[model samples]
Target: MQLPLPPSPMALPLSGRFPAPFLPPSMRKAGLLHPIASASLSPTIKDETIDWVEATSNFFEKDTRPIMLFDGVCNLCNGGVRFVRANDRNRRIRLEALQSDAGKKLLRRSGRAPDDISSVVLVEKDRSYIKSEAVLRIMEYLELPFPQLALFLQFVPLFVRNIVYDNIADNRYTLFGRSESCEI
Candidate 1:
């Protein structure tokens, strides 16, 4: 006999669209649409807390591109990367799948537990940010009103913000599906 498939996860209501200020004119004209690919820059984490600062410092010495560390196998993460790439004006971001060696090195340096890879990370200079904070920081650097949203998120309570972010992250695979290979 065949086993039944697991129930699909529930989807949260599509909350209001990102404020008009955040949407690019082209995207606004086209209406809300999911992006296929995007770019993201890593956040700056404090250097003093990380152990492998030397490695990171060496890697970044010659590279000026902003690095983005994300869950390589997550479809939702890949989509976000694509959206950022589309909106980036100066092309400042660089993508790095968290599963890659570079990503692992970055994580080790930051003193974060290995399992913390589940969240998106942004590494810049000697600083880093994770979860909702990372998301807000990234939006701030993007073109247009998206940066405005980051400013608004600052007023939100950390616990409340993280709770919502966690729910979406935990159920992302069920809602958006996943890929066998990393998106790169």
Candidate 2:
């Protein structure tokens, strides 16, 4: 008899890699294992405003600088973090690897799965941004020219910017490679 081939990582759903309990509650509700939704609010949240300060009161009480959560083992992500650290001379931004305890805590507090590392996450005092929005927001802390460029890019349609962001994110590991461990 021939041995059966194991399913590839891509073939497995997000829930397959993690136990049901580890998956987010929303994913568990429908018994579905899909990618995590955008870091923004869900469609059903149209009316009520979330008082994030009260929700995450203890977490952000002391430090209000934006915190960037990035993939620890991704070379491109690590390089991006390094770039921000070097350019943000005023210490305007804070950094954390998604795999860290602090990062996981923030992810949970932000209503994201602890294992969700598909996109960069930026947590400001009152709100959080992800993917392209996070990247552009982070740019505001960089040196002059980049900040100016970021302001200009703000006019671009979110869908258009996210299209570019998604393409790059999808190909990041293949294009920029992965690291054995987080550099910073």
TM-score of each: 0.69, 0.69
lDDT (Cα, tens digit) per residue for candidate 1, span 1-184: 3333322111111121111123445665886432321121113322133446665677679786657788888899989988888888787777788888888776655444344567787777656667887788788779988888789888998778889989999998999988888876
* Decoy 1 TM-score against native: 0.69
Q: What lDDT tens digits, residue by residue, belong to model 2 across residues 1-184?
A: 3333433321122221221123445666986543332223344332234542355556567877878999999999999988998899999998999999888766655555667888898877656677877888899889988889999998998789889999999999999999999877
Candidate 2: C-alpha lDDT: 0.71
Q: In order, what lDDT does every prediction score? A: 0.66, 0.71
Q: What is the number of residue pairs that collide in model 2?
A: 0
lDDT value, candidate 1, whole model: 0.66
